[model samples]
Target: MDTAPKRILLIDMDDILRRTLAEQLSAQDGLRPFPVASGEEALAHLAMHGADAALLDATLAAQGLIPALRAGGLSGPLLLLLPVGMGVPIGGDDHLTKPIRLGTLLTRLKALLNQTDTQSASAGMDDILSLGPYRFLPAAKRLETLDGTRIRLTEKETQILNHLCRRGGTAPREDILDGVWGYGAGINTHTLETHIYRLRRKLAAGQPLVMRIEGGYRLATAPVPA
Candidate 1:
C-alpha cells in the first residue's frame, strides 16, 4: 500500500476547478491537496489548520483579499491562478494563466513547494539553510533545537527561517522580502519579524539562535544550551 500524500490547501471558488486541480495533485508522491471555496475559509484553515502551500485565484472579487490573507500570516509560496486581463500581484510568489492544464499546474505547484532545489520537490531547501547553531532541513520542514529536539515547522515558518539563515548573519530586509516572500520589490521585512517571534517562542529564548539587528535582522552564531 502507498503512503498518504502531503497536505496542501487549494483555495478556489469554482467547484470544477477545485476538483480538477485536487485530482492532479493527488497523483504526486507525498502530495495531498485540500480544496476550499471561499477566501475566508481557506485562510482560516491556513492559520489554524495549516497547509504546505496555497493556490489562490487572482480574480477573487473581495477587495484587498490577497493582501488581507497574507497579513493574516501567510508564509508559504502562493500561486495566483490568473484571471482574464488580470496580471499577477506584486507580492505573489508566482502565477499561472488559467485554462486548467494538469501538467502545468503540477509543475508550477511542485516548484512552489520546492524552491531553487531542482532535484525533487520533496528535496527541501533545508540542507542549504543554517541559522544560529542549527541547520534547517527544508526538505523535511523540521528544525532541530541545539538540545536535539526536532520541531516540525509549517511551510511559511520554514521559508522565513530559511531567509534568516541564508543571510549568513546579514539578512537584508529587501533580500528577505524578495527571496523568502517572493516579492521582487516593495520589500518590507517587519513581516519577517512577526514570524521570527513565533518561531523563537517555540524554540525558546535561552537557545540563543535568532536575533534582531540594525539595517534589518541577522542570524548569528548561537551557543547551544548548557
Candidate 2:
C-alpha cells in the first residue's frame, strides 16, 4: 500500500470549524490538511500549492471560490460543507452538512483519494519521468537524484516540470501557463516566472536542468547514465 499522505485543502470562515477539521484530519495517518480562513486565502494557496482534495464551506459560495477553483486549474475532488438546512450545490464532488461526523468525512476523503489514484494509474501517469540525473514523480510530487537524495518540490514546481516533460521537454510561455495555471495566452501574471526562479534555485546543484528558451522553458533532455 502507498503510505504517502494526501494533502487536503481546508477552507472555512469559522475559525473553530477550520481548526477542528484541520486537527482531526491531521490526526489521520494518511491525511494532512492545509487550513485557510477565507476564500481569498484559499484561492491564493490553491493557485500556488495544489492539493489532492479540497474541503470548502458553503458560506464561501458568496465569495465564488468554487468557480475560482476551476479557473485556477484545480482538478481535484472537492467536498462542500453546508450549513444546517442548506441544500447541496452542484459544484462539489461530495458534500456534508454542518454538524459533520469526523468518521464520515474520513471515509469520503479516503474514497476520493482511492478513486484519484486508480484514475491516475489507468491514465499511465504513475510512472516516474527522468530529468537528467533526477527522477521526477508527478503523481507523488517528488524529485530525487541518482545518489538517493530526495528533493522537495512545491506544487507549482512539480506542475511546471510535469508540463514541460509532457511537451517533449519544451513548452512556450503561453502554452505552459495554459497547461499549468489554466490561464489564457493574453492574461499576464508573474506567478509563473516567480515559481520558475524559485525552482531553479532549488535545483541549482543539479545539472543545468531547467533552461529558458526564446519564449519559454525546457528540461534537460540529455540521457543520464543509470
Q: Where does candidate 1 stray beyond 4 Å?
A: 1-5, 116-226
User: Which parts of model 2 are misplaced by more than 4 Å?
Assistant: 1-3, 123-226
User: Per-residue alpha-carbon lDDT of model 2 for 1-226, expressed as tens digits?
Assistant: 7777888989998999899999999898988899999877877888898777899998786457787876776667777899998865545655678888998788666765665565455432566777778888767667889889987664456667777776778899999776655556886666567777777777888776788889888887732222
| TM-score against native, each model | 0.50, 0.53
Candidate lDDT values, in order: 0.64, 0.75
The alpha-carbon deviation from the true structure for residue 198 of candidate 2, after best TM-score superposition, in angstroms, is 41
Per-residue error for 18 in candidate 1, Å, reads 1.0
**lDDT, model 1, position 201:** 75
Cα lDDT tens digits for candidate 1, 1-226: 3254546778888899999888878877878888889888877887786765678877772345667666676656677788767854544545677775777677666655655332223333636455556766766667776677787665556666656654555676667656655455564334466666666777774465666777566655732222
Supply the global lDDT for candidate 1.
0.64
Tell me the alpha-carbon RMSD of every candidate: 9.7, 13.2
